[model samples]
Target chain A: MAELVTPAERRRLFTLLSPAYLWLLVAVFLPLSAMLFFSFLTDMPQDAPDWGVTLGNYAEFLTNPTYSTLLAKSLKLAVTVTFFCVLIGYPCALVLAKSIKGRSREALFLMVILPFWSNSLVRIFSWAIVLRGNGVLERAINFVLPFDVRLNLMFTTDAVVIGLVHSYLPYVILTLYLALQAVDDDLIDAARSMGASKLTILRRILLPLSLPGLLAGAVLVFVPVVGSFMEPRILGGRMGTYYGTVIEDQFVAVYNWPLGAALSFILLAVVIVILAAASPVLKRAQT
Target chain B: MSRVDVANVTKKFGQAVALDDVSITFEDGGFFALLGPSGSGKTTLLRTIAGFYFPEAGTIRIGEQNVETVPVEKRDIGMMFQNYALFPNMSVADNVGFGLRVRKTPAAEEKRRIAEALELVQLGAMANRKPSQLSGGQRQRVALARAIVTNPRVLLLDEPLSALDKTLRVDMQIELKRIQREIGITTIFVTHDQEEALTLSDRIGILKAGRIVQAGPPREVYDRPIDAFAAGFLGEANWLPEAALSGLSLPGSPGGRRFATRPEMLSISAEAPGEGRNAVKGRLQQRVFAGAMATCLVDVAGQQWKLVARDRDIPELPGGGEVWLSWDPADTLAVPA
Candidate 1:
């Protein structure tokens, strides 16, 4: 191996790493620090000269029941969407990684991830075209059944969840496919050769072995969905006024950037806590 | 204990014939080895017997039950994979107890059996350790313990000792034989290593091109191979040209085929023996001194013959010089042309 670091090499190392680190500082850390500062203020500095530091933005969240309710709604939506994505994606990944072979597996994996090639918001809008009152979904359901059916799912929470699941399902499957592919086929054979049932093999071998990837995919989906405002607004219509939309309103419509920053800071704190709690179990599952 | 019988078993993967009408029988409580070169269907036969790959055209019977349609899980068998395949997440005790748990054995009996199995492998003290925490040899032992804890009717080992270093492998061979003997389980071991097959098995079946070429005890297969393939596969076979058998008659019919004998059975000297023994005069082609033993390649009538002896027993002889090689005719064997 070559030596990775030296006193004279430090200049070259700094040159190689500075571009990415500087981009992160300018693009992420600076904005986050500015948001943290603004979250403790009474108003945006551009709005008035008398603006000063205040805890009123955070206190509004505690005193008003609506913000907490909307936050809970957003969190619940994230949980439901993550659950559906995992439930549907894991088996698809298993079939891709284990059952299919060679060229066909690669083709099918590409098909599964094909949705990710397009913009996610476009996909959500496409779902709106399919799930409207007199749309393709209702017609298809009616065609399958012997009776007429109306699927006015455009403004429902179910529509929002369906769109979100479609958006994130590929991520879960990709993680799980790589993880499942790494598991030795001989281990499954060893288990089956010992009189283990199919369910036993899945519960004890596949699930435990793939848990880390599963949790990673879930966290990735959950974090984005918690802060998502576009998909719900596009698909849920009047029913889409969750915590994310309230924050969006504060920034763009109400001109209350401080309150939006306060809400964004609280959500970030929640995400960090969730990640910290799950890290230990995730670490064990990896091995 | 159970006897496993594979009768006229044929298996094909799409257009490729992996096993072609292979037939063999493993005796009750006998340690049997399926020996062959890679892609010779030795592993296919072993996996078929273990119920992993069902044969296309024949029956596999464990004891008295024909298990052609039986899935691997329903078959009463234990198999150790080539890589050991110890569950990385489970403790040693948990891995051993897995089979018992699958069988729905009572907790108390499962515990006792797991302990007994671990003790049999001499890994009882490391029950709580994960497989990752153990050495390669220890991981192999844990895999063995896990396989046998359920007391299945047949034990299948798929090149189980190939991963170990030579010293550890020899020790494990003895350990494996002891455990199998103690349990009195019918064992079928698959290996391409002929010495491992000869050393470990009570009965050996030699396979080629997905068919059984010969099946017999180790000595029978080595000393009386049915063909040149078997003779050369199990060990070295020094072939004697037809011209060398002119006046010297061998014990067997010779059947107008090549004759061969193990190198160890031949003796080299500066002078021919004054008796009715098979003797030939040749120039020593090359002498190789491997530790403790030496081999001389002798060219007799343009045919190369080999003779092995102890390093000290090989009298001082010039390399590429004239020598006389002799062996008892009874030690002679004939191979198919």
Candidate 2:
């Protein structure tokens, strides 16, 4: 009776899942659990034996207007960056999918993806070079324009958006490209032959078929841009008074690990809400 | 009454010439077919006429207007692609109504035309269903409906029935002929299947390597081929070597030379016929009984000849037995090497 209790059936299931379960426990679940636990604890400065459960850290971040403002700024930046990425990405994807001819199309596609292959730090530093005071781009623009204007190209909200768009444009292009390429070209030709003009074909057939790619690309751009710390910190410079700095200050400089952990959890919750909002659009597009 | 005249149409993609300087004329309401193998430029020719592809040098006249520079949508010609090309997102009624809608016909008139087109294709019940939900043949009918909805002057079909199964293809061939007759529009069908071309076309144009090699009625092209290519392409023919015709006077051959014989035209017997003008004595090489008829292979003058005959009161020559192969002089066709 003991032997036949459940092991005979459950053993196979356990074997089937043991590796993935172990990985989740060791890599993902354990770290999240530690963060959750640490968020509620208070520790003494440079001393032992001060661990206690408390809501003070959560209260300080939630109640503080500065932290709340930083959070809102991050979201606004993410939305703006995602919008630009999608607008630019869709036409690039369409060109890759439909317009460019044969081998040149493949070469152009490779050029679009080439920037992403470089290390992110190098890419960020290159932006730093171009956006700094009197960089090459600034010099070139000044030479072309009428007046000698040191255009404030870097360390602004616009600079942050530019960096974000540069960083995530590849993702948008790749996802939208996949979606656009999957469209049955015959459908487009059919519309044209049936007397639908080129504009009508795009409006009726091409756009709808590529909706899933647009949704996926939007989510991919938005989610990461929301949580990004480097580009805004590097490009925004002093004006980069965003949520990442606040969270970093709490975690690294202020010695308030719990508060920083709490802030991270709040950011995670925002991401969840975003994903929830985006999922329905994706599902609707699929059918 | 709209007649189509294509003069000196040529298209080239890079260095590869897709369509040579080919000219063809279609009378108003003529059911013509462009028959050829793959890469023979039939589709390119059709697309050029439809104005999708502008030729390197040519003029395409529909009625009396030269439409070489006109865009595809502005040309007002209907085209049915091989895969039917029905919009997956649109319902059958919407698909059929697309042309009328494009022309900006009123909603009531569009609805009436849509209904009539669908009725013509016998797809009235399937009006509300999307193209993906329909069968292969049904989708083709919807494409037909869509093409004919606006009453275009010329209808172009690019191997429209090639995607269907063999039986459905035959059924659709009959249906296509019937529809073309009823519509009385200048219809140009492109297909590689010779039988389908013969069945559906009022006139057939055989293309080879971007040029029309022969153009005539299907019967004339089949019964009286111009050269070796047409003879081999139209149907089965036993091509005899030139050296085999020692005593027959063949066309274009200065001396008595070679000719080709269709298997169905040649008669076989154990004893030689008394009044045989084109007769050769040989031994039976192989015999294959195909239910109603038997196909016999006879080796004559260092060449093998096939004879197909009905099962009648004829002596059956055993394989390897002596036999005589003969055909009527009228059945022999002179072919160039």
TM-score between model 1 and native: 0.94
Model 1 misses residue B6 by how many Å? 1.7
Q: What's model 2's overall lDDT?
A: 0.84
Error of 1 at A102 (Å): 2.2
Q: What docking grade applies to model 1?
A: medium
What lDDT would each prediction earn against the true structure?
0.90, 0.84
lDDT of 2 by residue, A47-132 (tens): 54767888887887778888888889999998999899988998899989988769999898888898789898788889888888
Q: For residue B55, what is the lDDT in candidate 2?
A: 91
Give per-candidate clash totals. Answer: 0, 0
Q: Supply candidate 2's per-residue lDDT for B91.
A: 84
lDDT of 1 by residue, A181-264 (tens): 888999999999989998999999899988888998998899999989988888999998988889999888998999999999
Candidate 1 chain A, poorest ten consecutive residues by summed lDDT:
A1-10
Candidate 1's DockQ is 0.76
For candidate 1, give the lDDT of residue B152. 89
Interface RMSD of 2: 1.5
